[model samples]
Target: MARYDAIVVGAGFGGMGAAIQLDRLGLSDYVILEREADLGGTWHVNRYPGLAVDIASVTYSYSFEPNPYWSRLFAPGEELRRYAQHVAERYGLRRRMRFGTAVEQARWDADRRHWVVTTGSGELTARFLITATGFLSQPYTPPFPGIDGFTGRIVHTTAWPDDLDLTGQRVGVIGTGATAVQLVPELADVAAELTVFQRTPIWVVPKVDTPIPAAVQRLFAALPVTQRAARLANTAVLEAIMVAGVLEFTRAKVLNRGAGLLAKAHLRTSVRDPETRRALTPGYDFGCKRPTFSNRYFRVFNSAHVRLETGSIAEVTAGGIALADGSEVALDTLVLATGFDLWQANFPAITVRGRDGVDLGAWWRASRFQAYEGITVPRFPNFLSLNSPYSYSGLSYFTTVEAQMKHMGRLLGELARRGAATFEVTERANAEFLDRVTERLGTSVFYGGDCGSARSYYFDPHGEAALLRPTSTLNAHREAVRFPLDDYVYGGVPA
Candidate 1:
């Protein structure tokens, strides 16, 4: 059995960031267990065509480790993967990582005051357990009737096979989310005929994608301050948009409408057919689901070779898909762009047994998934769930990571100061935090707007918005960093 001071599950951006933080704290006894053969998490796994970052490259990167060599404003998957590799190597995290290891279960040992984590290879005990498994770690595929009968090549965006070519083949892509928006345009030029099945229309604004000029890259490389300025500028713009789209401030509705008009104009300019444009427009609010950015997605609908199907899919036939109206579209290859199962499969998949055989998954289900400051739960001692419920404050996840690190860092510092073996947030503190967040969310666009009807994954099974934090990025950071330490019970087991 292997033992350490800490064990980070998953080697994605969150996991790598946590490992780097621990290393900075002079705590060398830690190991990163990654399920894949390599790092980069989503960037490494999803290799579908036209894979790229929707957010600006500058803002998407970590502030602690900035990359000035991004080839474009919005980076491709390969570039992001390279950035992850660079961060790992620069911070000396590659040596501490255990590749090709999947964590199966984690049980808290009350007497020992440690976590016994079971993996595919063996078990390891750690004083602290940090889950950086990520929200989109698991992929979801809808089960259509007669799907097994389909003889054609079928693939999900998350599990795209390498060397699988669709050139000149009749293809059909299901789901119109962010992934499908990027993919349809790329497939338009390759497939002989393309069919897009849309369950709900997504609002897509123009992506101002441009190559990073050589002079700009050189300037960024020469002076690091310029790169930092660019990152800040990009983050400010994203935050402004978030305030308009998600928050319900005095002028928020007006700003949201203005943004919607811009998206509508872009759609109109891209597609000539009024009927096609109407079919493509989203009925819900702009920020109901994650708004996407693309320059080629809308134009793909205007192409003579592409067709959009909005009717209900009655069933999937061996030859093709059959609609409820008895219409069938033949296809040689099918791709599912359906997103992920975060709350259902991803979070609950790991068997976490806390004190007295209490299951964390069952508790979350019964209480409608929550955490204290989106990091600590009541019964889970010396554990942190990074980027979990109500943790994400801004558009970019880097802010969330930084905020969580601040909170966790303070806790660790206090533990050392008191010479404590373990700590856990009190139930009162958790409930108070949840109450404050819920009160703020009640007035937010996600709660009062048409978001509930949009079927976005942001809302849980209980129709409560458990994904995004209701406050500004700065506010969330301040709360996490400076909140009262008395809200937690430190040292020894609970009575």
Candidate 2:
């Protein structure tokens, strides 16, 4: 078995960031295990039409290796993939990475203090393991009646066939998430007729996208300090605005209503048809599910070729989709915008052990996977989950990621310097931290029973909110970044 000091899982932004930091800190003995054949994670897999980042392109890059070559306000998937590959090569991370080798299960070698890592090829051992396998890695397709028997091409946005063409065919697109938002408009132009099956409506915003000029890109690259300062300023301003929108501490119900009203006005202004505009508009509050934007999505309905069905897809027939209203739609192609099992899809790929033969999944399952401060969990010693559950902020994912990772790095560094074998968060510390998180989330509009759409993944099974962090990114950042060295229980994995 091959031995290493650490093992990093997944090759997405989080994992790449982790590996880059580890190597820069002189921990290159670590290996990054990628399930796919290449470095890009979601970016590589998702190649559907008109796909682009909803966030601004300028600040979406890594703070360490800032890229100034983004061609648009919203960078497309391919450019991001190239950027990932470029960053990996630049950092010399590809040398230590093990592509196409997935860690099936990792067994903790308790007697010797190391992880016996099992992959598709063989087994290896490592002193430490990092679960950078991000919040959304796995694509989940819901099982529908006669789905396999459908006499049509079936495709998932996360796993699109690059060669597959939809020209002049009748298409059935299901689920109105980000993928459907972008693809529906593109498909409208090509398909003879398109039917969209939406289980619930999501808030749609206009994506104000524009291509960045080559001159601007060159100028930003030329002045590193200017780029950094602009990024910091942009980050701060957006975060402040978002925090105010979420918190009920000072804002009135009228104010919250006003924000929602403003979003509605934008929708009406872009989408000319009243019926078409209302169909695309969400009945729920903003940020119930992550709001998506595409200038084309709303206007796509104006095309006589497209039809949006807000009714639930009762089942899939051989011909097409069976709506809840006993209506049948015909199609030659089917696209599922049903998103990945975001929070818990990677549970099967992981094998984590804690004290007394305690299984991490089982412990987490018992608690329904809620973590303290959305960072630490009881029993999982020295295990750090990046962008973990409930810690995810829709407003600024990158900022939260960098701040929390920097904090985890500090604790890991202290443990390494002290020769500590293992470290686990104490139960009391976690309980107190979680109380604050849950309390803050309680008052947010996401949990306010007013907005009516079917219970979303943003809410837990028992009707508790799950998707967002507490109001303030600054508060969450400070809580995560300013960890006291004395609070962590330290012992080496080999102790």
Candidate 3:
């Protein structure tokens, strides 16, 4: 069995950020274990048609490492994959990565003051463990009756196969989420007959996407400050929509309403038919569920070959799908763009046993999902979860990563100063943080708006919108750097 100072259970940007922090703290004895054979987590895994960053390319990346060569405002999935490779190479993180290694479980050894991580190959121990296995790691395929009996090609957006062409084939897509929004248009162009099964309509606004000129790229490369300004501008717009319009809905209702009206107007202008527009329109508030920016999604409905089916799905047959209205749609291929299983499968991603044999998944299910500062949890010593509850702050995931990096810096610096072997958040501190966030969420759209029909992943089965931190990005960053050091109890021998 090998041992190290730390073990990071992902190779995504989150895990990379954690590893960078560990390196900065002089704790270089760490390894990154990735389930896939490559480094770019979602970027490497998801290769469906029309896949691109919904957020602007200028703001989607790490603030510290900006890619000035992005071909378009919303860079394609391939660009993101390349960007991940660039970051990994630039940070010298490739040497520490172990691909094709999936961690099955991790248990805290109280007597030894380390984490014993179990994988298929063997077990490894580490003084600290950071689980950055992204929130969208697990893909969900709803168990529609007779789905297994389907003889046609069945594909999930997450596990899209290479060289699988849908050209001239009758295809059925079973989602209308962000991935489906991007993919449906692409499929409609190629499929001889296309049927979209939308359970809940999604709110989509017009995307301001355009290719970046070579001159503009050169300017950004020469003066990095220009890109920084652009990123700041985009971040501000997203902050207003997410923080003010959603979290501060009680006070900034106008902003939220204005956004909804904009989307409605876009939908009205794009779709020719009034009934089709109505069918595509979302009934819930704008911020109830995650929205997407798209110029082609609504317009694709105008195509004669495309058909929208709002009827409830009864089951999947050997031939095709059966609807609740006794209608059937035969297809050569069935695509499941049902998105990720967040609340159930991905909250913990892997089994984690902490002090006193406390299972993290069971605890979150039995109680409320929470993490102290979205990093540390009580009874989980020397463990940090990058994708924990209230961790996601803004539209750009990089914001969350940078903020958590700051948090790790502060917390780990204190640990080094104290020469402690382990650090765990106090139960009182964790409870206080959870209570504060829950109280603040009372004003958010997920809690106050008509989210019952939205079917948003933000709300768990317990009806708690514990996904995003109910605070501005600036505030989250500030708190990350200035959080009370006493909240955590550092113990054991000197490092």
Candidate 4:
């Protein structure tokens, strides 16, 4: 069996970040396991049309390695993928990484004080395990009736084929999440007729996306500080929005009301049909669900060839989609904009057995998914999960990865300092952290608003919110840095 200091699963931003941290700590014996043939994780997998980042391009990159060559304010997926590859190649992570290796299961060996990971190729052991598999790694397609009967081409945004073409073909997209918002607009321009199936409406804000001028790019390249300033400026605006829209409900109510009004005005201007505008508008309060930004989304409905179906999908016929009203829409292609299983406990599709053979999935099923500072969980010795459970960053996902990677580095450092072979968060400490996290989460608009009834993944089946961290990004960063090592239990002989 191959052995290493640490084993990181998933080659996304989180996994790459973890690898970089390990390298910086001089622990060069770590390998990143990527399921796909290449790095960039989601960025490499998702290659749909009109796919661009919702966040500003300037702030989307790592704070340590800023990219000054971003073409637009909202960068497309390919650029981000290239950036990920660049980061890996620059840090010499590509050679050490094991691509096309999918981890099947990981079991903790109590006697050896290490993890035995089973993959497609063979078994590998590591003193420490890091799961950076990402939240949206698993794409979920709802089992609609007769969905298999559809002879037409079926596509999901997560696994978009490169050679697949929809030009001059009748296309139907089901679900109106973030991907649909960007895709429908692109499809409208090419497809002979585009039909959008919506079960619930999401809050749409204007995405003020613009190309970064060549001179500005040149300036950013000449003076790196200027790009940093731009990133900070964008960060400040996004932080303020998150604070107003979630952290402070009283303030959020006012701010979100104003934002909603602006969205309404945009909708009114874009969609002239009163019925279409009404159908697009969400009934729940803003911030109840994941809010999306798109300047062209609302305008897509204005196309004469585009049609939005608000009724429930009765079933999928061989010809096309059948509505509950006995109406059928013929289509040549079917695109399931259906999102991933965001809150599913069985993520990564890996069976992780901790001490006493405790299954991670069963544990989460029995109790609410809780983690110490969203990184380590009780009973999971020498394991850290990045961007999982409460570790999610509201303003930026990069913040979550940064903080967790830093914290994981600290844990590894402490292990080396004490010569301990194993470290796990104490049950008492995990419980105490949960007490505080749940209390703080209650104060957010997710609980105060009508989010419980909305089609949001933020709230779990038990009415508990576990998707995002309740505190501000700054607070999360500070907490990750200042977290006391005494909160965990370190064991085993000296390394």
Q: Point to the candidate with the largest lDDT.
A: 3
* Candidate 3, pairs of clashing residues: none
Q: In candidate 2, which residue pairs clash? A: 420-491, 420-492, 421-491, 421-492, 421-493, 422-491, 422-492
For candidate 4, the lDDT comes to: 0.86
Stretches of candidate 2 off by over 4 Å are 247-255, 343-349, 449-454, 492-495
Candidates 1 and 2, the one with greater lDDT: 1
Per-model tally of clashing residue pairs: 0, 7, 0, 0
> What is candidate 3's lDDT per residue for 1-495, written digit by digit as tens?
899999999999999999989999999999999999999899999999999999999999999899999999999999999999999999999999999998999999999999999999999999999999998999999999999999999999988999999999999999999999999999999999999999999999999999999999999999999999999999999999998899999888898999999999999999999999999999999999999999999998999999999999998999999999998999899999999999895569999999999999999999989999998999999999999999999999999999999999999999989888889999999999999999999999887777878999988878899899999999999999999999999999843
What TM-score against the true fold does each predicted structure earn?
0.97, 0.93, 0.99, 0.98
Query: Can you write out model 1's per-residue Cα lDDT over 209-295, one digit (the tens) per residue?
Result: 999998999999899899999998998888888865677633478878887899999999999999999999988888878889999
Question: Could you give candidate 4's per-residue lDDT for residues 257-376 as a string of tens digits?
Answer: 777788788888889899999999888777777788998899989888999999898999998999899999998999999988866655535778999999887788677877899988
Model 2 residue 121 CA deviation in Å: 1.8
* Two-way lDDT contest, 3 vs 4, winner: 3
Off by over 4 Å in 4: none
Instruction: Using TM-score, rank the candidates from best to worst.
Output: 3, 4, 1, 2
lDDT of 2 by residue, 1-495 (tens): 888877888887877877776765666788888888888777777889887777776677788788888888789888989988998899888888888987787766666777777898998877667777766667778889889889888998888888988999999888888788888888888899998887677676556788888888898899988778867776775665455555452344565566567768777877778877777767776655666667777777777888878787778888898888898898899998888775453453476665566766656555765666666667666566664657675365676566666766777788788877776777777776667777876666765535457446666544566556765666766766576766677874443
Query: Scored by Cα lDDT, where does model 2 land?
Result: 0.73
